[model samples]
Target: MDNVISVRDLRVLDGKKTLVGPVTFELAPGTTTGLCGPSGAGKSTVLRALVDLLPHGLTRDGHLEVQGRPIRYGKGDSGLRSKVVLVPQTPVVFGGSILDNAVFGLRHLVRASREDLRGRVEQALKEAGLWKEVHNRLDTPAQSLSAGQRQRLCLARALALEPAALLLDEPTSALDERSRDTVEESVAALRGSRTVLLVSHDPAQVERLCCRTVRLEHPETMALTSTAA
Candidate 1:
């Protein structure tokens, strides 16, 4: 498998709290990797460190790469961040129409043609299992939608950017059973095409979507493969 991301002895420290282990893992293209750890174990931080979104002077060590390219650290690499979108635990739906929220940042940060935008947006919404529920409500304010809808909307928003990799922090944690199923389906479909790193406490969910699993015990500990577990 072609590797898209690699973390070698990655260390991330924020003041006195170390957020990442000397993590060493490689993400092969088109495979899904599930990240599991105790709360505050820095599963999210590992991803953020890769994208350089940690607090200023957080201090990151070791080598990281993405899509065969070094994950360029430092400032002014906004474009790189776009290629590796991170969807947090909370759903972030803006106050505007759902369509606007989905395509809002894309218009300014993304440079796709008008035709491409329409197709990709529709595809993402459909893939996210939101198209049927939102087909006629594209112009409706996202606030009018239910919380579950908003969560799916965020997933759609991330998918709209055409990211090569997606970092998800419990993407289904805030949803109901139905909404959770939608997220699971979306993840199942996403695994073989995009490099996905998901931090999930749900073991069943991890087994459903992940090809491999890694558990981070503490900041100084090593990333242990759970595929053998």
Candidate 2:
């Protein structure tokens, strides 16, 4: 299968000190790959690096490509990010109705008529496993949703972009068991259709959701980093 994203010798540095990477991995099309490691292993940092969203004062070095195209640090990062959506650990909902939140990013990124946009949002909602619950309440305030529902709402918002790949950062970590199950079901549904890179501390969750796994660790006196599957 073709890879949606590939990284070779990727690393983040803070004024000459290695903070993350010197590791490599590939996300294949339509496959869910789990990124797991102990705390402080830079799992989240790796995700940000993929999209060129590395924090201030952190610089990346390596070969990074998306859909076979090289991703320069500042050049076209926004475009690359739009194509590969990232859903952070915390769900962020802007002030608007549920429908507004779902269509927020879409309106700026996708050019379509109102009717067409609505159609796309509806499909995305269903894909994110949120359609049935919010179908009639789309006009309602988005802030009214519970934590679980808000997370799903965020998922739907990302799905609306019809991205080539998804970078999920601890997607179920903030939810209760029941809510986690629901989110897991939604992710499982994307297995054969969407390429996903899931970051999680829970071995069981990774085992359940990922077809392959990449383990990252602190380099600790090593000159190079390696990834294991």
Judge candidate 1 against the unseen true structure and give its global Cα lDDT, from 0 to 1: 0.81
- Give one digit per residue, the lDDT tens place, for model 2 in 74-113: 5656677688889999999999899999999899988899
Error of 2 at 23 (Å): 1.4
Q: Which clashing pairs does model 1 show?
A: none
Q: Which portions of model 2 show Cα errors greater than 4 Å?
A: 220-229
Worst 10 residues of 2 by lDDT: 220-229
How high is the CA lDDT of each candidate model? 0.81, 0.87
